[model samples]
Target: MTQPEPLPSAAATPAPAEPPSRPSLPSLPGLPDLPDSHVDAVELSGPRFQTEPAQVYRELRQRHGPVAPVLLHGGVPAWLVLGYREVLQVTQDAALFSRDSSLWRLWSAIPEDWPLRPLIGEKQESILFTVGEVHRKRADAVNEALFGIDPFALRDRSERIADTLIDGFCERGSSDLIAEYARLLPALVLAYFFGFSDSEADEVTHSINDMMDGAETAVESQAAFYTACRELVAAKREHPGADATSRLISRSPTGSEEEIVQDLMVMFAAAHQPTAEWIGNTLRLMLTDERFALSLSGGRRSVGWAMNEVLWEDTPSQNVAGRWPTRDTVLGGQRLHAGDLLVLGFAAANTDPQVRPDPAVSTQGNSAFLSFGHGEHGCPMTGRESAETIARAGIEALLDRLPDVDLAVPAQDLLWRPSPWMRGLSALPVRFTPGPRTLG
Candidate 1:
């Protein structure tokens, strides 16, 4: 089928009066240059949506200037919208740009009843994937449920969990930080949020890890997680607990055991991977950058800065947000037909010079980084207040309990997650002098 036509307004926006300032293109450390051999292949297939799209994106920006059409994932036609202004416009204008992926013809191949549909499809209530009013409402509820709880109330319990994991590693002198520590912490927190008991929390964590390793998409893993969530919600209904999941279930309009369970699964699936990557990336940054590590060691407040820097320098989700053109619109001086898919390259946009003054300093928490995104659809959870609260507390506890922590292996030897959508170290082995267990 012919790709959807670009809405009329797609061609109406005038190009900016002045060119955006951006750093001169830099060669990737180790990658082949685009060949004339694949020019036709590329156009037919669309932009390659692989682990190293950054190189292709940089090349497109240089060759096409700002706005250019490129194929994505082999054959899907999409506008590789680069430059700060264009990206900002596309991300902010909900009317012009729609985040609904269902409109795209590419996803039509998947059956409507596919398990992954609620997680990645274009349907309303697909919190992370849908767009328009439905996206707004469900997203608001999810955010409220996720962040609405007082993380401080659980600080004591969280610290105990963090310390117990750290102690196990300090004794061994080396452990896979990602698999053992970073991954475990968030799952435990999420379990508490879902009102699972401590032992039940361990079970949920194991189930989540298994599901992540086993399934390629959110739908593939939903059945197992949904089952666990359903059990927990049923228990909460009988004996209302103090956890966030229970609280949300209590107040929800759709408080049936099934709906509550499904929503929890959606929330956990959306949050688990991203948060795990964040923790893994944060540890990697501290271990590699002595200057950054020193800053964290010197003051507890610096953790927020460090987290922001990591978000920019090591963007976890390369393709977190997407939009389809609602009407004809011009982004980066390229006309977009209605139904055309516009994938926001947070990785590319975060490093753009026009939007960020020193793209390289993204590691330094420059205010301009688009890590959390921008406009109405931007990640509302990021900002000074939340960052200070979460990072400071976690880092302070870590430093107080494990002051001499150092990587056991060379930084270059670390393995990174293979997905382009998220950047994270697969494992972090470290040795630290153990301190007296003061809290746990």
Candidate 2:
């Protein structure tokens, strides 16, 4: 729950005291290393994400080089990998940075009620926890379901859904973009694809919200999520349709109901938040940045350009948890335990000087950013219906239709959710001239 990076403090008084720059932890003989329990629990929504993450990350980079130690929600210590090349080296090397829970040192120490349980905890065996052959087998079924979808066609359907959602608010000349458009579209799309009815989709979205937001009832919501997914899977199995759930169930090598349900749950859970945040953040970028607004609106710039820039500058998921070292190793001049937990700072790495001295160049292509990550454990949304395609399509639907759309409030006033793991807005109130329903 710590900030991605802590920034230099702002002194409101006459003078500001300089925080002693501790660049690297001392690994001297007989000197005790910093304990994970000692690191502060500064949640993302706790005034850090809005005002401090970038600066905090910058300070860590200046001090530690690339990877630095930080405390997760439960006083669980882990290394936050902040360098671009360093992140690539760690994530790409499966033998070194294993994703298997067997290598996670801090998981056992974490208390049951830890607030980040929903984000970091996995009660059931899913693709996120396994590695090697296990991951390959489980991933094949999930990938067949995910990569099988057509992105261009999915975009068309998502656009139609976006239009319907907009129609609800178009008359008022104002809307909460996050709630009405960004969030709802994916829920509806995923629900339809998984064979859930409209009412079920609404409830599924509710459970998904509770789970993703780490609400106090998250664990309960996760249970409810499992139940809903099982029902969906069961129905699909009995009546086998063209939906992803049906495909996943039929293709699964294990042929186990529990495993099938877990995989289905993972697919929905993974897609919901990241995809929504990408749309919301990308829209926020297009609206707030005048150059972006003008260029994209006028067709002088491409949606692909805006999407790439947002992916690099403000990654939808700032912190990716659960990358552990398979053996004792030295990272960023600090010694790591064999099974120590480490975080991948996707946003920080995207900004690492070694990767891109000028972030604006991110729009130019090359696609080296770790936001989608790489290697065997990379994002499953790799094919056409990827975040990039969905976001571009969704953004086009809104901007192309509502060109006058602008922030209803000052950009500075917009709020960001406090969960340290995600980079998302609480709401995006937008106002545009009343537009007609795009749907017939």
Candidate 3:
């Protein structure tokens, strides 16, 4: 059987170029549009992403020549950078492409019901939207906190959590892997790091996932998230622990409780769903691709190898939005004006013929694509290691327990959540021989 091939054959080849873009169209534009917003912007959030992002990314690549236009949450216009080298140019050259959302042109024009307001608004205190000195200050604290994490201990905790979660369904012989395993493992692990009780992990994940869905409840979910983080911060301050959150509280430069709370919130919010979804994506590979499955489960290939493949092909965030241009610039022959918002097409860039060219071989670093982001805004020291370890140990425990696990439903029937920026399976139902539960 053919290996996953890093998301279909198109990933190994350059996306076919489309006919010239047509400007002045009322709806999303065709491929021929040139020079940044010359044609209408395509909608980034929709069924298209939920179904096939690689296919959609290839189409977008063909359509606008890599740096094209896309409408964000609430019909906001922005450039979607699809080329690998172009993504590198935008993310690495922070001088030209700033993370500061203030430069985002649509911030002021967006409607009150703007769906991504929490993610992009200035009121959101996550370091993701900061730039320059402010970002450095935040990153410093985060980096230190991440450094304090004990990976060995973290891995052990993750395995135990995975075993616990599997016990909830192993006896039934059928389960939605996404909800029961992939999604829960990271949440519980993160709750430990954030110094919350394991029992609270489900609620933490539910709130973050709700925010990711951007439903009517999302606003209220985020507000509740704030309150939880604030409480966690106070508890950590009053009675410190060795967890990552306590480290963050001690290292944070801010005296304001609000700033401290934002730091903790971003840690849990940023780390949970995206990490969980990507873990789900990796599990999908194990279930669908026989060669990949055998290699991973048989110990010939490590989970890290499979994970890199997932990041290359089925990254959690297909199109991470909102990198505003700091000045008028030209990227891939596309003219980008100052404050022109740009979305980094991580999946598309990973497949760019100029970058990967051959999925059969592995790319050595995270910088190979924007999966973990780049430059000042990249994930912290223990971030990648901690995440990979958790995913690996959790999956390993399950595979050890249920080597015959396979999809309970057809792969095509599985659906992903519909969000403009991220890609994640809504549920992954699986069936395995009924087995005794793992003991505590």
Runs of candidate 2 exceeding 4 Å displacement: 1-45, 295-301, 360-362, 381-384
Candidate lDDT values, in order:
0.61, 0.74, 0.74
As a whole number from 0 to 100, the lDDT of residue 163 in candidate 2 is: 83
Which residue pairs collide in model 2, if any? 5-56, 5-57, 6-56, 7-55, 7-56, 23-63, 45-418
Q: Please, what are the lDDT tens digits per residue for candidate 3 over residues 197-232? A: 755667777777677666689878888777778888
Off by over 4 Å in 1: 1-56, 65-74, 109-119, 122-125, 129-132, 214-221, 253-259, 295-301, 360-365, 382-392, 434-440
Q: Give one digit per residue, the lDDT tens place, for model 2 in 132-218.
A: 888889889998887667666677777777788878888888999998888887877778777788889888988888877668997
Q: Estimate each model's TM-score.
A: 0.77, 0.88, 0.88
lDDT by residue for model 1 (1-440), tens: 23321111212234333333222223233323333322321231211333345554555565555655544332334565567677788887877787767666446444455333433455544345556665666556556666666766556656777877777666555667788877777778667766778888887787787666544643444455667787777777788766767665765654556555656776675566666677777777777887577754565545666677766767676655367887776677666667766667677776665656554543553566666677776765722233334344555566666666778888878777645456667678887765554434
Least accurate 10 contiguous residues by lDDT in model 1: 3-12
Task: Rank by TM-score, highest first.
Answer: 2, 3, 1
Question: Is 1 or 3 the stronger prediction by TM-score?
Answer: 3
Which ten residues in a row are the worst by lDDT in model 2? 22-31
Deviating ranges (above 4 Å) for candidate 3:
1-36, 295-302, 359-367
